[model samples]
Target: MLLALLGVAAFSLTFPSTAWGLESFGPWSLVALRGVLAALIAGAFLLAGRVPVPDRRHWAGLAVVGGGVVVGFPLLTTLALRTSTTSHAAVVVGLLPLTTAAFAALRTGRRPSRAFWLAALAGAAVVLGYTVRESGGSLSTGDMYLFGALLVCAAGYTEGGRLAAVMPGWQVIGWALVLCLPLAATGAVTALAVEPVRLTAHGALGLGWVAAGSTFLGMYLWYRGMASIGIARASQLQLAQPLLTLVWSVLLLGEELSPAAPVAAAGVLMCIALTQRARS
Candidate 1:
């Protein structure tokens, strides 16, 4: 439960750092650099801790989870924010719990209760309405990428939760970091090719957040939470993250709050309540 509780706070720090990373390179480059650094840190821990090697089955999962959650989600979401506003991205990401919940239901064939469905539906509606109000155009390339990233991340979260059920905190994420290195290297090359990124003090600080808080610490906590509380309950804690991001954006970036803040907050709160009730 504590793990679930901390998920939002961890993610809150990570997502905003996405903006910080872009100060140097494009989203992909930032992802590439961050991934390499995270992998190195995790690799050092693995060596120091004597972590076990992956079996074949572990490899299969490591591949998908690495591609889907670690790489795909951050990459897409960062790219989306390059064009879209922070609130716009926040509203969509606020629905991640609903996506994870739906995936859990599909995977387990466990029927969601009426309130679960109702809250999920209402949350989606609120997100859509918020998007329409903020971004008047039809879904852009960035939106599709963000949505796909969310779906891939949902799958990864579910699986990572299961991995946490057995593995040590460092091991599960260490393995993820280990498996993600190759692609991250490729992403780094790609990022440099496109953006020619350089490190100013702010860029370095931003990457520091990406390296430590966002990837290393945030991911570990998220997995620990999922491990302890189960994905169904833990994922619900994401409700706080978007709201927190909105608050941060307003305070830090001087972005104006939309009039619909109350409705969006209500939607997220209602969903969190319904998910909590179902879990209990």
Candidate 2:
């Protein structure tokens, strides 16, 4: 539980960091370069540990994990944040616990109780309602990107949790990043060739935070905790992430909090608690 909470705490800073990073960096450059940086760090970790190469079957799982997290989520969220506030993005991403639970069910072939479904549906309704109301009854492009990021992130989280059950948690993310090093290198180079990257001190620090903390360290703790606690129950911990993010947004980005934010947070959190109570 401490491990999971630590991981969630790390992740809760991602949106605000990305928003800060965007002040000087292009979304594409930030995403590509961040992956390249994380890959290097992961490579160093594996090399020092003298980890054996993964098998062919493990390669497939690593690819899925890398594609969703190392690429899809960061890229999409960066682009989404180009138009959306950290607060808005945080609220939308608050739905991740339910999505992660759904993917965990699919991966494990377990059916949650009907009460779980009801709680999940109610949580989804609350999130969707907040989204629609916030967006003036139509989904913005940013929201669409966030939704895509949500699905891909859910897939990554579920797959990584599965992998962690068989391997060290840090090694799981490290190898997953290593498997995509070639592609990440190519993307980073290509983005650089297309446009120049301008990084202020703050932007550089923000990029480092996401690459090191969000991309690698957070996954290590998260996968380890999930492996220990079971993904379904571990996912319940994510319900607190958005609230932390909202607090960070207010502190770091000086974003104003809406009264609706806390109310909606409470509603969704209640639903999450109900879902957690329903066993398989």
- lDDT per model, in order? 0.75, 0.88
Tens digits of per-residue lDDT for model 1 on 107-210?
64656677767766776677777766766747777677778878988887777777777776556767887789998998798768878776676677777887
- TM-score of the candidate numbered 2? 0.95
Off by over 4 Å in 1: none
- Tens-place lDDT per residue, model 2, 90-181, is 88987888899899999988777889878877877787788788888898999999999999999999999999999998988999898778
**Leading candidate by TM-score:** 2
Q: RMSD in angstroms, all models?
A: 2.0, 1.4
Instruction: Write down the TM-score of every candidate.
Output: 0.91, 0.95
Worst 10 residues of 1 by lDDT: 271-280
